[model samples]
Target: MLPPRTYVFFGLNAVRILGIISMLLVFASSIFVLVHDVQAVNRFMAEASESDMQDCDYIPGSTVPNQPAGVFWAVVNRLLIIFQVIILILSEVGWPLAFFDRFFPVLGSAFGLGALGIFQALIGAAILSHHVDDFTLVTAFFLFAIGCLNMLLGLIFREGAKARRSITNWRAQAKSVLPSAEDFRPAFVRPNSSFVPSMFKSGAGEERAEKSGFGFGRQGEKAAGLKGFLISKPLESLPRYAPPPRSEGSRSNSPEPQFKSSKYAI
Candidate 1:
């Protein structure tokens, strides 16, 4: 699997960089509006030859007359005031989001983007509608939001690519570890006892006498004392190399000695 630490650190840094950029844009745009507001007031005060009424704070003080903007400059000045407030709000959010983003960087980035995109796009659309030709300084905010969105997408794709490679490598390793089918074979588990004389009896009690040392019957005489398959010549008996196998009914005791009788009529 992909290393978790590398993936998370890289993804987090991407979000942090985006946040810093957002904050920078906020500061830059705010300063531009503040300077523009001062310049407009100075030009008006210089032409009218009156005392200064505007404050040097973030936004220009609200109009004392409480009337709609009359001249083009008046409209431009009020728009600048709105832009200043937005910049302060954005800057407040950006740096704080960056700090909190380490735990859930992706989610934090999405949250930041949501706020940034809506406000910047709204302002951009408004500027375009007004045909304001000198909004270059404030345009940084729009670009920054768009840039953050791209960075977030890039991080997502990078993690996905790493994960896919890890899976492929795992499957390849498993294939190497598994045993092959060609090495398998079954076993033989039973004894070979097919050579008994009864097997050649042909479904009867009589067995065909043959010179192959297998016999079960003779003419009409029956050797009654102790009958067994006998050999005509000892050399034609069972092979000499084979071990003597005891018969099923035979015992280990010695056989009785044979008795001899004198030739006399009783």
Candidate 2:
């Protein structure tokens, strides 16, 4: 895919084209109203001079307030357009000098374009509202539509720019957070035998001593010898006492005495 800057470049040009068209419409509508009003004033003067009724006073401002406002906005719009055009020409021509980085310095920006779009839209709406029944209505309507489209494009570009900036900032933060290969190294932990309980380790040491035919010390050798001696002895060697048998004919009517034996006694 193409880069975002390329898209923005094309989009800005589109806005400029639409803006130029809207400006032309504004000029046409404003000129039509001014010319019509001027003609009306001339007719009224002629009628008045030709012995017309004194009550036939023609007031120019009484027609509609939108005519004057439309003219005012048209003038302002021309100036703004001229300013942007000059900046664009200067930036482009001085590109090799690196004097300016952007094509349309201020109005080329997202917020600036949005503001311009809003201004044009307001002007178009005002003019269209007053010229509803006149031929100028068509031009005013077109101007209004173009202005709204420009506004939408401006807002979309602005959001795109914001997203790009946010992504750039996030990437910068992530890069700062990541550790460098030079500064990062993996460490492996080794278990210390000193921290282990002797009871759990003694069995392994005893087994090793028996296999090697050598003990860890005198205590280990004695423990090994004792364990070997016990394993070699027979179970019959332990003495067990026998209880006397009772006969059914002996009617003593007495309970047998209970005896508790120790663990080793059995």
Candidate 3:
């Protein structure tokens, strides 16, 4: 049943470490991939494909149409998008709680939905027929990566749900093992209040020698005292089913372990 809450704690830690390692790698990879090739970094930055170059065209005297830079921009945007998604998901789900519980999984699901939207668009569009291999590979990688992350989030939520079910079952069993509220409740006191000595004062106030009915506290005290304070009654004097007293002397002389107790009245 999800191996208890302790296992969940371990799962959380593992998820955090995994996220940290992944985030650093993804961030570095995103930045490193920003350049098209070795030449782009070494030479292109100095030239003016930089967009800082004024647009110009020689259609006689027409304004220059902006030239599409290269697939490098596409790759850069995709990388940035992926890195952003990773950072967001890890921050929302993979932090303090791993095996992310309810909230993060929901957020991850929303991200998955967004990814699905892109997947749909990629599947429908055909702008890169000449570079079919390139477009297909990039699209497939994005979909696969997003799907895997979404699936991991689902697993975390599934485990949390399992843990919840087990707790419910434990509560059901524990209710049966536990003593009921009524069992520990003393009849001499208020329904939930502490034992009050005044409950025992009634028997002592009878006008006649002993005509009044026995008070609840007197009966309880006498019964408890027989076990704890007067366990030395002779066999003939004991109740029919009474077992032999474990102690035969006053409590002060008893060899049995005694709990030292002090009472406070409020």
Candidate 4:
């Protein structure tokens, strides 16, 4: 998870500052290399052999190895600067333009810095391989260092931005899923209508009665007297259980008691 807004603001400002510094470095180095390449090209053209000219008639010949690579990097650096400035400006300005970051983070500082880092590394490697002058050597070293820094910053920024987006998306989803005030309205009330049903009138009267107290007002009196108006009626009683009458055939099936007569028996 990313830190809170207070830290995020500071973090973004720091990233922007670092990005600007990287852009400046790239611009200055690219300009230096480009100027040097141009001068070298002029010198090469001036001292070129007739056979060298014949071999390459379209473009000027250069004795410098990987001369094209220098010019190519110069162009690439210029483009990188342009994009970096745009990303930084858009990020700082906020709101409408900030939407650019929201919609396309790939075009944002994270991706821009990452691309610049990768490009700088490539340029440093090219400089190391092709030419080794004191100025170029120092430039390459700085570029390599700056490139690594940019890459690290890019990664941190990307993860932070991802977390931020996720938080926003979560809040939006939660808001959408939650029940609104309209959802809690009484069942008798229609969603599209302003009219409340008469069923709620009794409830409103009860509320008023409670506020005024039982004997304070006519409404309170009515509320209190409602129970008196409701009379209690006695419930009908259930029948008691009884045995069924015996049939003659059933009586005949039963054995009779035998009586013995004794003298003076009553």
Candidate 5:
């Protein structure tokens, strides 16, 4: 069976999803209302009689009335435009803020939604009073739906803190059971040490090189050659290659002495 925390997490997610869906529907419906309003206004202007046109307030290049009722529809259009802008800003800003501070976004969205509900209620009342048309009544209904969904989502966000905490604890426990990076290393293998070349000399040879001022035979020769090349000097100008000087007691001309064991002499 799934854990309680898992259920809670999913429930919260579902609420948030519903909230998003409702808001999107509201946005689409509002756009439809705006378009319908524009078409209605144009139709009214086209069908208006010559006497009615004179009674209507004149807008440049159009005979649409601007005085009493025209101004009201114009105001509604502006309000819908502002509402769209607010919805866009809230969605863009509030969602990311929710990731950091959950409570604030929840409260803010709730407040905004409540305000939308009130606005829609007023529009619905206007429609009932014959101040606005049936299209606005439909828009009002969409706004009310969006407002309810947003409020429900806000309530879920506010109450889901305990669920969030449980989920976080579950994650930490899961992490504890997993292997760490260090555990991935091979247990039987040792780390490699810095490399020492096979040609490296020790003891007497090392001391001899140190005493001669050159670090090593091959390295000194190579360094000198490279230095000559870098300085633009000809190969002939380089020092003549000479054998390393031998100690007086250990001359190369002396043959190594051989020892004879008496028991093996036969």
Candidate 6:
């Protein structure tokens, strides 16, 4: 058994499909009127005299004086307009009830196109009554085509809604099946102890030195004064003749022996 929401979705889709079919019907009817009826009307108007052209009513069984074809096309055009209006209303109502998001614009477009179709139909009828031209019929055809496109867009939006719903359902299902971060566990047991000490433990000596106000080298002695900030002479600037310092052990082990020059006797 299907869920209630699924039923609603299917119902909305059915309404949308019906709207598209009606729009196509309107488009085809307009084309028929343009090709068959409009041409026949134009031919009759062209052949008839000025006296015959003045009256809008069609006379039956008379070839030169009547335009029954034009009257029939006008009637069919108006009927199509009525059908388009009903479909537009259904679409506007159905889309809002089905989808809770971002469907108003699509509804508005359909409404606008339906209105344009009616307007064009009326204008075409008026023009056909008096002055029938190629431009009139072409414009009417184009307007009906736009209405069909609006229906096609609505169908596309319906498909998009279905896709969005499917994705949302998939995400919900995945979230239900997958474990959360807190529940995750490693395959192997990890050691709690580390060879390297923590920063907090390492900083203990430095903290004690800071509290005693003595530097790192000697304990019980204060830090160096501002003279420490002065730069010492670089190695290259030191006197070359100066001897290197000797270690305490080496100095203590030295024997008190007199040195003899190379020119003197040993």
Number of the top lDDT candidate? 4
Candidate 3 residues 1-266, lDDT tens each? Answer: 66564564455445444544444444444444343233343443466564444443211111112245543454555465565546454543435334333555543322323332233234223212222234334543444454454356445554343233244444664567674455654556566554555433444455432444345566755755765855444455778799776555565586778776768633
Write the residue-wise lDDT of candidate 2 on 28-49 in tens digits. 5566566565565556546545
Instruction: Please give each candidate's TM-score.
Output: 0.30, 0.38, 0.30, 0.38, 0.39, 0.31
RMSD of 5: 16.1
C-alpha lDDT score of every prediction, in listed order? 0.45, 0.52, 0.43, 0.55, 0.50, 0.48
RMSD after CA superposition, every candidate: 23.5, 22.0, 20.6, 14.6, 16.1, 21.8
Clashing pairs in 2: none
lDDT of 1 by residue, 161-237 (tens): 22232334446645785754443332222243344544454532334343233234553124421356343634546
lDDT for 175 in candidate 4 is 74
Report the lDDT tens digits of candidate 6 across residue range 1-266.
Answer: 97665664565445445445544544554454446555666677577786866664553222122554556656565566556545454544444434423454434422333333344345334434533335445554544454454445445554444333343554664567575345334423334434223322434667755554444443422244332543344575447798887799998999878877786666
Superposition error at 212 for model 5 (Å): 34
TM-score, prediction 6: 0.31
Backbone collision count in every prediction? 0, 0, 0, 0, 0, 0
TM-score of 3: 0.30
Q: For candidate 4, lDDT tens digit of each residue in 1-266?
A: 65475465556556545545544555565566556656776676678786775566233432144344655554565456445545544443333434656785554423445654565566556556644346656766676676676577667765454334333444664578564444666555666654554433444665755553555567655665775753344685555775666899989999898888989797
Q: Candidate 5: where is the Cα deviation over 4 Å?
A: 50-143, 149-266
Name the 10 consecutive residues with the lowest summed lDDT in model 1: 57-66
lDDT of candidate model 5 versus the reference:
0.50
Worst 10 residues of 5 by lDDT: 190-199
Ranking by lDDT: 4, 2, 5, 6, 1, 3
